[model samples]
Target: MTRGDDYVLGRGLADSVRLDAQHLLWKMHKGYELHPLIPRTDNMKIAEIGTGTGIWLFDIARQLPSSVQLHGFDISDNQYPSKELWPKNVSLGLLNSLIDPPAHLVGQYDVVHLRMWVPNIRGNDTSALIQHVKSLLKPGGYIQWEDADLVHQYVKGPKAQEFERRINKIFDKAGLDFRWVSDIPDRLTEKGFLVLESESGRFELDSIQECTKTYLLVLREYINGFKKLPDLDIQQMAKEEEIALDQLYLQYSHGIVYNWSPVSLLGRRDD
Candidate 1:
C-alpha cells in the first residue's frame, strides 16, 4: 500500500491553499458538497476519507445541522488545521482508509466520503479500499466518492490538449492508473454497495479560465514533487513538463482550458 506522503503532492501551506481552491472549483462544478440523493437524518455521522485540510467538512458543517458529527480522516495529518480552528461539530484524525479500519470505528458512520484519491489506488484494484470503507459504514449507509475521469480528459485548444497529454504521460510513467475512476459504479456494486447514481460535469466557459489557473498551480506542485524521485527519465520529463505547464498557463486567458471530467458517485451499503 502506498502511503499518503509517497504520492506526488506535498503537504504544505501552498498545497493546502491549492486544495481549498480545488475544492471550491469542484463545489462550483458539482453544485453541491454532499450529494442530494443522500437523505439526511438528525444527528447523523459523516466521515470524509482522504480529507485534506478538512475543508470539505468545514463547508458541510455550515450546511448541515450542528448536531451532525463531521469527521475528517487522512493517512497523514500534516495538512490538518489546528484543533482550535475546526468547526464546533468538525473533528480531524488520521486513518488510512486503504487498510482495514479499526474495530472501534467499524460500522460507525452513516456516510463515508472520499475525493481525489486516484493516486492512492495501486495495482488498478479498488476491492480492498471499498471493503475497508464499507466496514466503516452502517448497513444502509452511503458512500460518496469524487474523482476525476483522467482517462477521458479533454481540452478545448490544441495547446491545452498537448499539455494534458504530457501530464497523462507523466502520470503513466509514474505508475498511476486512473482508469479505476470510471469503474466506481461497477466496483461499488460488486462490493455490496447499491449504486445510487453518479454525476459528471466539466468546468464551463465562465469558470474555465479561473479553474485552469488554479489547476495549473496545483499541477506544477505535483510536478515539483514528482521530480524528487531518483529516476533520471522522470526528472527529465518533469523538466519538460514545467515548460509545457507554463505555456499552457499563458494560453488559459486566450479561452484555452482543459476539460476535467469530475465524476461523483453515491452508493449505499447493502444491508
Candidate 2:
C-alpha cells in the first residue's frame, strides 16, 4: 500500500491549510525555527521528515544562507509547493522516514528535523523508527524534534475536561499515542545520540486567540478526516467526537479551549 493509504488523516486542501497554519503557530510558540543551540555552518544540509507542505523548510530558508541546502521528504507530496515557488536551495521528495532511508541519503544530512509525527508512530515502540532516522544523519549530525505533549493536556472545567478525554479516545482509536513524544530524548539517547536539550511550552489561548482557534480547527479537521477513513467504527467515533466538541462550545458560550503543551528537543549523533 502507498504511504498515504496508511495515514489516518485524509490528505486534502483543508489538511494542507491546517499544516501551514500549524507551522506558523508552532514557530510563534517556540520563538525559533531551528533551535539556537544547533550550530550552523556554511553549506550545511538540513532535512525535515514528514514535511507537510514543506512550509517549515521554506520559513527556515529565509533565516539561513542561500547556500544552505534544505530538503523535505513526505509520504505524500499532495501538499508540496509547485516548482519555482519555493527557495532554489529547498528540494522536496517522497520518502517515508519510518523506513530505512535510501543509501544515497544515508549519513547525508548535517541535521534532521521532525515535527508532529505522533500519529504516524504506529506502535509504542520507537526503536526501529528511531534507527531509520539515525541512518539518515551524518556522524555528529543533529536531530531537532517538536511535538505536542498531549499527555499533559488540560482544560478549565469538567465539561472541557470531558471534551479532552473524548478527543484523546479518538486518537487512541486511530492508533496514536501522545506519550511517545515525552520519551523522545530517552529514545535518542539509546540510539547513541546526546540529548542536548528538551523543553516544552503551552499553547495558551489567552495569549493568542487566533493561534488557539487555529489549533482547535486542526483538531476538528482530524475528526473530519477520520470520517473519510475506510473503517466504519472509526467514522462513528469521529461523529461522536464532533458532537462532543460542539456541545462543549455551546455550554461555554464565551469560549472553551483546551491547553496542549508542545515539546521540542535537540539531539546530536555521537560520532
Identify the leading candidate in terms of lDDT. 1
Give per-residue lDDT, candidate 1, residue 92.
Answer: 95
Q: Give the Å shift of residue 35 in candidate 2.
A: 1.3
What stretches of model 1 exceed 4 Å from their correct place? none
lDDT score at residue 84, model 1, on the 0-100 scale: 93
The CA lDDT of each predicted structure is 0.84, 0.80
lDDT of each residue in 1-271, candidate 2, tens digit only: 1244477665688778878887877877878999888888989999998898999999999999999999999888888889789899999998877667889999999999998876676667777667877998999999999887778765566777777777777778777776888888988898999999998766655445444455566667778878987879989988988887776546553565566677889999995
User: Model 1 over residues 4-74: C-alpha lDDT tens digits?
Assistant: 54767777888889889878878887889999888888799999988999999999999999999999998
